[model samples]
Target: MMAKIKEFILLKIVIPIVDMMMGMKISYWYKKINKLNSLSRDKITEWQNRQFRDLIRFAYEHTVYYKEIIDKSGYSIDDFTSTDDICRLPVLTKEIIRQRYSDIVPDNITKIPHRKHSTGGSTGEPLRFIIDENTWGYVTAAKIHAWKTTGFHYGEPFLSFGSSSLFRVNKKNRLHDIYYKLRNAIALNGMNMEDSICRKYIEIARKKRVKYIYGYASSIYILASYVKKHNVKYKLNAVFTTSEVLTPEYRQVIEEAFDSKVMDCYGAHDGGITAFEIERGSYFVGYNTFCEVENPLEISTLYCSNLIDFAFPMLRYEVGDAVVMDNTANTHYNGQIIKKIEGRTGDIIRLKNGHTITNPGFTVVFKQFNVKAYRIKQLSESSLVVTLVVLPNFKKEEESKIIDTIKKYAGDDCEIRVEYIDQFEPLENGKRRFIMSK
Candidate 1:
């Protein structure tokens, strides 16, 4: 009865109140999404076409970066009739964003309030940008709608696995605890999933009657392995995995352990690309994002444009993932479908002393620096090399801090070396590997 009351309050009173207080239009977006969900394929495409044209025109007129590029390309904003016409514009890469940060922001940025955010260092390129309340509202609504397709409700009791640096349990931040408590969700540290920690989380899930589980693919896989090994049982509505590739092996074990289906979601928050799995191998791209594959029929790079976000226009932005789009469009939801996505995969480094270190542990440490890109190469069991591409603000003294962080995970006696580079050479697959073991 209490859960039902809380759900009602969250979906009704609290959400609207918060939206009004923050000047967010989440309620407005919810209505828009509801309307879109019922529209026919032609209607959806019409909406997409209008939004795409508006985004291109807005960026060309408002942002210095896009204005200069569109002019150089010899194509005016008027030429962009369909989403496919975005190919005429140059692809925006992380390097371009880092170099031309100020130009990408709208000329009237000061007049429009926004929240500054930074992406995770998982891609070796952590990007900082601004997002207005409207974009935030749309993303929130899209996520809720995506999860709802898998029978998840807002304010339900669930467990979320995320970065440890962001979701710590220390008493330093009681509001974090209170926030999750109110949401009826628990946030577990994803970086460290030792057997004991996984066991504690498993017990916590059972005690809390958690109906859904959401988190990184690797962390959830580790927890699922432990659950299967111990013959522990759980009945859940579904497991939603993201941020990394959900391998077949990972999906099978997770479903068997929790007795639920696994739904995979792909999102590039910085690039504003979001898609959720609707069937086994097909993903339904949300109406708000214009997703493009550089080479459509074959496995190629993904570029996206956010139709709603104009505060900082990421036009034709490379999302740094390998994907193959289904040319055979499903006549549902603007006919956009991702047949396969080759998301990031985590690699572990096992020391001679039996201690293991993973990529995410280093990612958390690197997040504090002004690193443009990084790569960790394990030359041998005891020797490791970290190559970094840093911005002008990065100081020499920070090198010691990075070494200390690496030693913290890899052990003090391990031979560590740091080298500075301008940039990295892309692998054959066109994606950068954060960790490499020779």
Candidate 2:
């Protein structure tokens, strides 16, 4: 009864204000998904099968890009009855998105405003994709559902160190600034953080009694290192890490520092792969996202088919992450468990000013550049070598702007060398590490 009262006042009341102000109608999606999460395994499977069929048929009929691929392949949409037959179709890659950019989107996307997105260029070349109302509507809904996995109740505050685009404090938006505070969520600059900022981070966390902390594994690991060294304590309920790979060592440091469990999360830019850690080596994949493991013996890429994203069908989309699994989860599949997440890991770099930051954090600097791909490496204590594969349409002036952004974080004394390249060298496993520090 007390929980219900808390839910009514905090979730139903305060969260609704976020819905009203932001106009995302997040509460509607949140409530709907909460009930669906309680359904039987058989029921969820039945719904997923239906959704899979609907998505494949819709894509084959509507989108020209899917049409060519389906027509070329001997298999019909009828063959894909479940996850069993999705492999009959060829794996879709980021290269396909680049080739068939215009034709890949549904023809009726103009019916409502479409949101544009791009990958972080971590996996490979960053490819721009479009998400219509359905994509915007359901993906955020699934994310809210994923939040439950972090032990976060609806109304509790979260101090997020997310992508600079969303987290940056925009002084121009006065109304939004007020609403941001009221939502009990605060966004801190993860990219350019130093000891002074990290100290403020712990201070705010302690003062607000923030229930959760969200950031990239490396970014939080840096903060965790700080907290452990100083022995600062905050009433932290959980630490949520995402973006880069969450190794066991990083998890140990972060959890110990915050005096809370670290919950690792995985999601893709294409709105397909969504998962949150349930136990150390197990993650419960979101109900809306049906996943099939590809190359199980090797890199173990996840083919995510988003049931809710009809505006852009993500049928068997290869979200860039490698993994291993086991039959330990009884609820979702027959004990199907994600035993490990084998993504990229690198050391954080110390700037000339004696401040340290995650090397992957530098990816934010290259966001404005229309480069096809990039990789950053710490050459020495105060030097970085950035290799970029520029797109045909990229401008020269953007190069200067990117350099300025890097220097803003690393300081002017950091020996910076920008190398324009036709292509970047991939690792032995064929995946590129976005950041490398010796």
Q: Compared with the true structure, what per-residue lDDT tens digits does model 1 show for residues 1-438?
A: 666677677667766766776656777887798899898777887898898888788888888898899899988778888887877988988879888999999988877657777775336777788787777878777777888777677788888887654534454245434434677667776655656778899899988889899887877888887889888877788999987888899899898888888999888778776788878888888778888887887988888888888778887888888789987746555547898998677665666644445555456568788887888888898888999999899999999998987776577888889998888887677667887766
Query: Which clashing pairs does model 1 show?
Result: none
Give the whole-model CA lDDT for all candidates, comma-separated: 0.78, 0.70
RMSD after CA superposition, every candidate: 3.3, 3.3
TM-score of 1: 0.88
- What's the alpha carbon RMSD for model 1? 3.3
Please give, for residues 1-438, the per-residue lDDT of candidate 2 as tens digits.
543465466556665665565545557767766776777766777777887788788788888888888888887667778756677777776777778787878776665355677766445476778665454545566665666666566546777785664334455355546544555566776766678878988888877778688887877887888888888776467888887888778888888887888888876758555677766667767666777786555547767777766667767777766777554436544223566777656667786676565655555556667877787778888888888888898998887787777777678887788898888767765678776775
lDDT, candidate 1, residue 172?
25
Give per-residue lDDT, candidate 1, residue 422. Answer: 88
Clashing pairs in 2: 327-335, 328-335, 329-335
